[model samples]
Target: MTDHAREQATILETHGLTKDFKGFTAIKDINLSVQTGSIHALIGPNGAGKTTFFNLLTKFLKPTSGQIIYDGRDITHARPAGIAQRGLIRSFQISAVFPHLSARENVRIALQRKLKVSYHFWRPLRILDQLNEQAQATLEQVGLGKFGDVKAVELPYGQKRALEIATTIALEPRLMLLDEPTQGMSAEDVSTVTDLIKRVIEGRTIVMVEHNLNVVATLADQITVLNRGEILAEGNYDEVSNNPEVMEAYMGTTDAA
Candidate 1:
């Protein structure tokens, strides 16, 4: 890609961003810019306001000050639904699937929502074969094809996490915000999820909050370390990883991991 593409490719931008709850600041005067088609990782210790930042970007929470720009448009005050309609979507830190529904059914529901199809109780679900096919394809993309017929809650924890990814990908978002995508996963499961995340960023922008330094090192094209709700450093893996401030903030030591 050209330099212009690299710079102007910023799909998400925040300037002087701040958020406060009852006189307590959650995020302060933060500035962030994410390049298009890049995997940008946000890392910090517990209670560092990472989730609050995700909420702000996805329009779940309004900023007390500053602006949020997506694809050249000012979306600082847009509604969550409007942001999703504009091709920005977020997956929750917690599992957000219907436990009683089949994995395929969960993805199908997401597809229907993306297509804006009205729900009809009178019609049989079999009538939507095309939708089913799309959902299956999404499942395959996330390596959950064989589990499509299983109830979401019955699947293993790792599989359920994969299902969540499938559901998010089905929306075909231009930008995706993932919160703790690999939380509570095994080492093998973490690798699986990491590969899936890389694949999903083929033509989209991704911003995620992860505590796993290894995962961040593996997937993040750029890393932004947050401390006490403010940006401490942002750069490529090597840049941020080698920064003394980041080391001190995260590990409480300047020694390399």
Candidate 2:
């Protein structure tokens, strides 16, 4: 695709994305392009640079060499906070929730952060009420409408994950990057988070690094398989899963997750 068309349909892209630490290359020459509104999965064996690449994409780490483009603009050198302002947001495996705060309060805080407001809730009562309403709506969107009053620390494990997602939605991101959003949970929690992820993905682009192939198979519009920091295959689930090279890579590593 031409640059114009590519940029038009693509929401996030990386060209020659390479990162090296102490002469040890983590990712080498990775070229990935995620469509404007699609769920893209990044999967590979352990130590395949998935985390490193994720850190680079989210600006948690600067690339040794490469260009990261988001929404037709170069963001390779942008800081994490700057990238977030441009609508590319990322969440780590651990939920970033204030355990002492209620679910509603957590969402409210995230909204305030999104709006760049000072954390002094004493600013204005009227604006606080408005933020409350918006936070409730965001919570409702993630199936946490009934848990608004519950303390985040008191919530069930799955519910805490849901709360995290709700806070993320409050940011109104155009593109979201989730790192193992469903990492540790019961089967029921997995199902719950899976359904929630499906619901939240409407009209937005999502790129996730996940271990649950089941979730990836169910939700990902595109999948990229990485091995030893290099992309081994990329396509829909079936296409990449059927690749002999991908199977071989997985076979060598017991972590098929």
Candidate 3:
């Protein structure tokens, strides 16, 4: 097999994954697989269980029934930190960074998390200088170099998300789960974040929950549509977009967004 083909082998797999709350099933029997080095998107109308499924993958919610395997290891039972330690990092959420610190400081903490340096709280100040250097490099990679010294809270809306992504990159994740990476952004910021997302997908796998069809069309190597707690369609953008059922699924929904 070619190198790229080998890289496309299954890196994350879910079998019969199910979740329920008070007998109301949120996501049911989801059997999905994400190939290595691919940008895979999970999309659907609101309340189609997209977030619930995303939560299941992150272990934010335990599966009521099923298995989750990552890089040949069963991770269904792994805690969030444990899974993250194994290189399955998640992002595009509001809680990923501290607004009180500067961009460099926020990324420095992520570096500290990866190095497990937090345990040694007494580490010398000199060590943090090294971290700040590395953290600045990460910020540069995500197009936040100019804002490294600015407090995260003071950053513009889109830059905050970019800073959040830079922190996720610090983990060196093998598979990154992005929940609406461009949820609320101006058109120009959308273009900026889009380019950033493309830059970071190199040599890694990404699974994202996104609502922007234009973004999905541009980024997804494969798209999986979920509806009413099940897989509605799966294929390339053109293939799925032309699928009658998939088209019908979006009708009367906010898909025109």
Index of the highest-lDDT prediction: 2
Query: TM-scores of the models, in the given order?
Result: 0.93, 0.94, 0.93
* TM-score-based ranking: 2, 1, 3
Q: Candidates' lDDT values, in order?
A: 0.88, 0.90, 0.89
Q: Note the clash tally of each candidate.
A: 0, 0, 0
Better of 1 and 2 by TM-score: 2
The sequence of per-residue lDDT tens digits that candidate 2 reaches over residues 198-219 is 9998888999999988989999
- TM-score: model 1 vs. ground truth: 0.93
Q: For candidate 1, lDDT tens digit of each residue in 152-238?
A: 999988888889988888888999899999998899989888888988888888998998889999999888888899999999889
Give me the overall lDDT of model 2: 0.90
What is the C-alpha lDDT profile of model 3 across 1-257, one tens digit per residue?
A: 89656545989989999999999998989999899999999998888999999888889999999999998889998999899989998895564679999999999988987566777988885677778889989999999999988999999889999999999999899999999998888988888989999999998899999999999999999999999899989999998888777777888543532
TM-score of 3: 0.93
